[model samples]
Target: MTYPITRSYVAIAAPPLRSIPLHFSAACLTGALLTDIAYWRTAEMMWTNFSAWLLTFGLLLGALAAIAVLIDIFSGRLLLRGGLGWLYIIGNIAAFVVSLFNAFIHSRDAWASVVPTGLTLSIVAAVLIVINACLGWAIIRQRTGGLEE
Candidate 1:
């Protein structure tokens, strides 16, 4: 008599977007927002601390996330739930717009009180980004059937 052998397959829980991309997005945005805040508070030379580089890096990360999101959306790997995903995109857009305005104002005069206005907007955007990132991770975990993988 021959014995039957069975193989068991375990499913890995893959997120909508990998953790690295999401984490990169959060880190870059947080760094940009903090540097901007520091400049706003101290009226110091923002560029001395490489604020420009930080902002550029944050924007690059955001762009990468955007590309990944679009690809996932089109390929049906990520489903738009009209919640965190939309909020994430919106927050990024708002942050970009505010950052652009801040850059313009900063070019005019870094010490002006008006500089804070753009910085405030950026802060709000950063908060939204953070919230959206958390929500996104939760959603992905839920979709993948509980964070086992």
Candidate 2:
């Protein structure tokens, strides 16, 4: 005898994922990659090099991530209700601010450019964003009890 297939519709009670953390995580990683390019440009002392292109691309991605987060918030899929949410927001904001400073002001120098400062800021931002992602992942894991929710 063969067993019959069974299907059931189940409602998930766990809170919807807060996608902002993932977006910010991506932004930070992209920013860090751009910073690496910037540092390389500083070493080469060339402004109109591949670094500029990479920076522009990174900026675009960062903007997209921000827009995605905003849309998710408005659509009620993402929430900024808890401590982790706030931390994620703060980290993302700080990363954005520092990235702006590095890109606009400090990146202009020809010789040294903003390598040191921008690299430091990018690393810090990436760390914070990754930590925030980990926190969210931990929560989801705990809620799901080691299974996909």
Candidate 3:
């Protein structure tokens, strides 16, 4: 008599719960970018104020996310392996730095605030945030073995 073969599969775990702040930070930064554009088009003070508030919230959330990442790293719940992980870190740092500078620029008068320089920085920060998010999701997928929620 022949016996049937059996196979077993292991389940992949979900990403760390602390990553929520990082996601929120990304959204706020993206929203700031949109508001910066709105201010540029309409020269409206309200949009400028909105961009400033968004950038502030993004910075605060990003700081919390950084702390959470450190905690995860120390607790062995998250791993940063190879160059991709470093790239993600560097990208996030760059995005945050750019946004910080843009926030300072936005503190100026309405018309001068989001013109050439402020708008340029917002664009750069938004682009960097997007790239970091892509890299982060790729890392998560790799860790999860392409598993879906």
Best by TM-score: 3
Model 2's lDDT to the true fold? Answer: 0.57
Instruction: List the candidates ranked by TM-score, beginning with the highest.
Output: 3, 1, 2
Q: What ordering of candidates by lDDT runs from best to worst?
A: 3, 1, 2
Candidate 2, residue 146: lDDT: 80
**lDDT, model 1, position 92:** 57
User: In model 3, which runs have C-alpha deviations exceeding 4 angstroms?
Assistant: 1-14
lDDT of 2 at 36: 62
How would you encode candidate 1's per-residue C-alpha lDDT over 1-149 as one tens digit per residue? 99899899976645555345656756765666677777767767754245555555666676676777777788776766767667656755676666556445444555552355646655765776677667666667766668544
How does residue 13 of candidate 2 score in lDDT? 62
Per-residue alpha-carbon lDDT of candidate 3 for residues 7-50, written as tens digits (9 for 90 to 100): 99976665675589988998998999899899888887999999
How would you encode candidate 2's per-residue C-alpha lDDT over 1-149 as one tens digit per residue? 99999999888663443354446445645655564665555565443244445445555566666777677667765556677666766766666665565555344655444456555655665675577668657555654578766
Worst lDDT 10-window in candidate 3 = 10-19
Overall lDDT per candidate, in order of appearance: 0.62, 0.57, 0.86
Which of candidates 2 and 3 reaches a greater TM-score?
3
